[model samples]
Target: MSSVSRTSPTLATLPVDMVKHITDYLDIDSLWNLACTSKVFMEFIQDLKIRTGGYHVDIQKGSYRIELPAEHYCYCNWEEDDDYLIDDLNKDFKDFQSLFPENIDFLRIDPNLVRNFDRFHQECTVLSIGAHPMEYCRFKAETCPTEKLDLLLNNVNFRKGLALNGPKPLVTENKKIFNIDWLLIRNVTWITPEFIRKLKNKIVYLMGTESLTEKDINEYLKDLKSGKIDNRNLQVIGFNTGFGRPRYDREQVLNGLDTTQVLDQTYKVADYDKRIESELFIGTSSANGDIKIFRSFDFNRDDGTKVSVEFMYRTVRVYIWNQDKEQEKEKVTKKRGHAKDTNGPAAKNPYSHHSSPPPNVYNCGVSRYLLPGNIDYLLIDPKIAGKFKNVMDCAILSIVTFRKGLALNGVIPKMWKIWNIDWLQIRNSSIPIPLSMLYNKIINLWDISTITEPQINRYLLDIRDGAIDQPNLSLIQFRKQSGWNSQEILSGLGTVRCQERKIYKLKDFDEKMRMDTFLPFGLDENGIELRDTFDFVRRKDGVKCSVVLLDWVVRVYVWNQMETKKRARGHPEDKDTNDATAKKSCY
Candidate 1:
């Protein structure tokens, strides 16, 4: 304790900056070990920055820098001399030689191992041949001893050729060799018949617009037949042929294929517009015609390109043929009937005096009703007359009759109770007794259970007389009963007779005589002036039995009278005529 001790500076005792610089070159594992040795050294080593090839490392301002090969560094024990001499040394050497082949570069091995290095160089190329001057300068700047350069250089394998020993035997053909045929053509543009022939043994991927015309298709088929093009082993990836939009037709294309045998292989044809229509045609039409007319030979290839070809027209025109010879005979018969009507009697006036009358009596009866006259005698039963008390009530009643000894054959009498005398006059003067009612009444009156043929004929004659304005009666009701056969009724009417001993035939009547009539009464003075009534004298077997004034009144006259007097008036014109002709007309 009395003597002064001389201090020996240990690594730990070294300046903080110096220790940092020393640990900078150490591997990551070694640096970590060093940091655990002491607090001061721990901080120093922990703060050091170390970077490897192509990698960056960061550190604090006071930390060290380490440049080392990452693959060669065993970072766990950097400070151990045995680890430095064996593990790191061999690892750096192996890593250095791996960067170059032995034949391309030479290694400056130890003099004792020079012979072994020469043999190794003959077989392999050296990765790196000389000392790295840049690495040496870096170490020198950090105050590393120049002798360290020699130690670093020993790890490298220097090539004799790189060292000015005259280029070492060239390493001929270093890359791997492969057969060219093994390579495949992936991108295809145009595939010709010749190209297809050459690829008989190889797999070919086809794409793009390979449009073939009818002629071309035919030629291709001919070639196939003559063995010009080889189609064997041909595997098409994407094959398409069609035309552009609006012009594309698939029917023509398919028709061309049908005629020619070009595609012996199963090639998928798609984006075909014409093909769809062709299939529809085959389904709808029975004609075995070519599909050229319906669709255009338009198609698209695998690459979305258009292909087209023209096809010859082979459509079969279907005509409707009449094989029956009797059709002509029927036509001749129809012509004869038409000619008879066109050139027959009364051709100039088909509706002449011989023409049939209208079916309904209303039109003519209304004409008679509108004639100026006055009501003289109201033919009605007293019991029926008592029913109408109110004017409105009177308008609702109607006069209906059923005549016996006719087709209807039943009891029916004309009876009425009504208001609105004007409406009654209009209706009474228009509608006639229905034939069915007449037939039914006659059967009831004469005690006849069934209508005889003559009775049926009589009812029809009465209906016809009213319909034609030949009789004073009006045929009002004859509405066909539900489900009643018109043809059967016509057939019955064709062979019926009337009570007056007159025969009635359906052929004797025309269409007008079978239809109801609608009369148009005029509203003008000219029409009003035409209004007149006549006296009807009934004579049975040449004896004067009854005389009656056919009283008529124009609607306008009633309306005028109502307007002037503010009340309805009877037919004055008919009354005047009735008074003047009563003595001569009345029996």
Candidate 2:
């Protein structure tokens, strides 16, 4: 018999799983070579689940990198490889595309190197034109990746005669010029209605259109209203008249619609030196209900030094976009099951007077430990507890406990009677809650920030007249940023001293003052410091108190012999031994 010829097994001869595992370890160039070797390998490479890092090549630097996920990269310094061919660069790039036709998401290419971008335009999402200085030049590509390429045009000069009719034709059908969704044209003083009519974009920003007039704007608005062409995709038209003699009455042009004048007067155009003083008019268009108008004026100062050169007059309008209809449609589509609204209240808007409180179940809060139990303290109404869920329970407790107490200078007043509470303890929180919560609940009123004299007088009258049914508040205290409005809260309370005393002198003290005030050490042998103490006899029903006013934390000093003995004996029931906790009261 004869001799037999032997051939090595091809990569495809192995199982697909083994081939996939082997390919995973291969570099970009090796994979590219492998795909080029045979049809079987090409099909295998195309079917491989590869996450492409965009096909980016910096041909100028003779360096390129194929970006991959998870920081795994394959780079080529063409300078190091003497065999690298610059003449066949386009052919090589086409080979990469042919291997993975659906892989390229974005391409950053030098505008000069691209001859007919249309021929090389892969079915991709975004095709960036120019380099860094022109990167802002972006275009939206084909909606479907396999359809065609699209481009985003940014910062491109569109001078009067240069853009529409030039030697190369700035825009052409072979380039698929009409498919752009966003167009940003700068340094253009004039854009004919016909030109604006032909643009198929959802949003357009035209800057430096100093030559544009009110008639042009009116025609544009009218065309938008009539819907002459199928530019329904056209949603927003933004343009600005450059700083010059012509000043359009933007408000007058935008008449016959609901408008709100944003009066802050602080605005500037993007990437320009000029400062803009304009009344931002936000409202729906009278011509087309679906086309909203957010236009502003470019006002000049008396010196004319500060002028607005670049700014879009109009922005996205919600009403014209049928926001309510869309919202209703979304609401219906997302209607899975009945769920309560989590936001505290519902109203027409922030400024609207109509509102209703949130559902009753929404009030559970951050510090549930401090929240008044439904039966124990009755500090908060269970039905409305959900409304105050966001505020610290401790803060509410503090405000409800201390805010209503009698404000006094010499001695603590009969706060228990006024607030219907037996105890008051207060401390400052790391995060302070708003004072309005306390002010509103105690006073039963609103708008605490701008409390007018009349409002204050009226509130005092209501309290004196018993016209307002104040809550049966007890232990009203709050750790606040500012001290309680002492003068306001204590206005009607007459000056009263609960106790007065003169301290007994110690034997060693010449001034007959308390020895404990000057002593750096503990009491001496004679216990002179003990005799220098002053005492106040508590009323039979006096309420226990612990109050912190700003930086000062004040507490009742009870010197009862039996309680001191209990504390010294380590009695578990003596709650006062722990300084951080409050002692429980029978009430």
Candidate 3:
């Protein structure tokens, strides 16, 4: 029999600092095992403990002591040795948990070490899976609750050949009991739709080499086209060159679809000097056939070691279907300015609701006559008529002109007359104006006065001065008072007034009103003619009489035949010399 060495390797055998450095990479199980191997290893681990204490407990002389309120417990350990550490440490940890009834908030075991989860019961909330493929697969299938699992795999093999078969039994058994929150896979290449389905509530984070055979790509495309795959649930997909030079353009990598037998996609590519390291894609699709893609790129450290990295990101185009059905539905249900009355079918007597008797024949308060189809014949109460006479005149004229196919200018008075009807109350009582009539009146009045230059200017001024305050003032009131209803007709005028005020406040009157005083007809300094030419004068026989004041003032006056002859002889244009001199003197 070969002689076996009794003394196992200890921390003293290696540099203490170097041994501590190695512990950083070892998982929790390795650390626990290292502590259990010997007194020296245990002492070293205790002395080099990395956790900063938020809560503390002191078990002096073998008696357990609680020092803080316990909500949950999390433990992590690391060690250098495998055999002496892993096997024994797991056994002791389980035994210790049984003796100590405190709850475990989360339990993470190194994949290299065997796990006995039956001892912990429901105490475990979080677990980690490492690069060991067989061990990870077995742990997921046996110990992990499918729905509750928080899988963290770093530099792990998740290729087609190494993938787990079907849904793990544990996942199926406990899915109703819990929901998976997260699934982190690093340096993983193959992830299937089935795998995604199994991890429904879980958000997946994937990194590393990404490759899909042409067949697989075609299948994915088929699913996208057929609506079998719900792309809305797919939150993110990312790709980046790892440890090697970029073999393909980043854009080609993202655009999954092929055009001209070449895939053209857009991707955020990191700089080469930055040593492009990783990429992250995030966001989900919408139910209405919309896909939102968010992409980010990371830069590797220049030192070639694991260090701080920089990331840049952008959201690319969103894919959506043009939905005409919604627009069509909106159009069908949309409300218009006028809708057919729904109180009842068309009235047998449309004029039965008339407020007054026919206008051509007054019946006072006794007889109600049908309102004539000809609005001019409709009778209004005397009191109302008196208040809205101008408005009525304007309205009647407008209706007559409109019916006669007259110009718009002739229809304004009729519109104004109808608008004035709003103030036609019964004595002291307020009479509600019919919305239809009021609208018609407004439309007519707007058409008439809106076209005139003087009316527009006055309207603008009234609006600017806030003279029209009430938005619901009656037209009858406006006409009787020589003003528009402050309430009903002035709300729209506020904006116009504000703009006019700003312009007027900023305008230069002196520069704009410059005058010229050189011409025969009262010309000002700015060369603007103040009077009409001789052609504008009225002619009587061969002589002309001034039709305007300025023209009259500019005509030459000859006291006698000799003076007239002299003036005529002097110059044909000298007839207005006196007027021109007068204009200059006035200036």
Task: Name the best candidate (by lDDT).
Answer: 2
Q: lDDT per residue, candidate 3, 319-433, as tens digits?
A: 2221243345546775553221111122112122223323532232212221123321222222333333455533434323232111121122223344333122111112322
Judge candidate 1 against the unseen true structure and give its global Cα lDDT, from 0 to 1. Answer: 0.25
* lDDT of candidates 1 onward, in order: 0.25, 0.33, 0.28
Better of 1 and 3 by TM-score: 3
Write down the TM-score of every candidate: 0.14, 0.32, 0.23
lDDT of 3 at 113: 28
Candidate 1 to truth, TM: 0.14
lDDT by residue for model 2 over 267-303, one digit each (tens)? 3112110001000111111212222113333322232
> In order, how many clashes per candidate?
60, 17, 37
Off by over 4 Å in 3: 1-106, 114-123, 131-179, 187-201, 210-226, 230-234, 237-242, 245-587
Identify the candidate with maximal TM-score.
Answer: 2
Please report the TM-score between candidate 2 and the true structure.
0.32
Candidate 2 displacement at residue 119 in angstroms:
6.9
**Candidate 3: Cα lDDT at 101:** 27
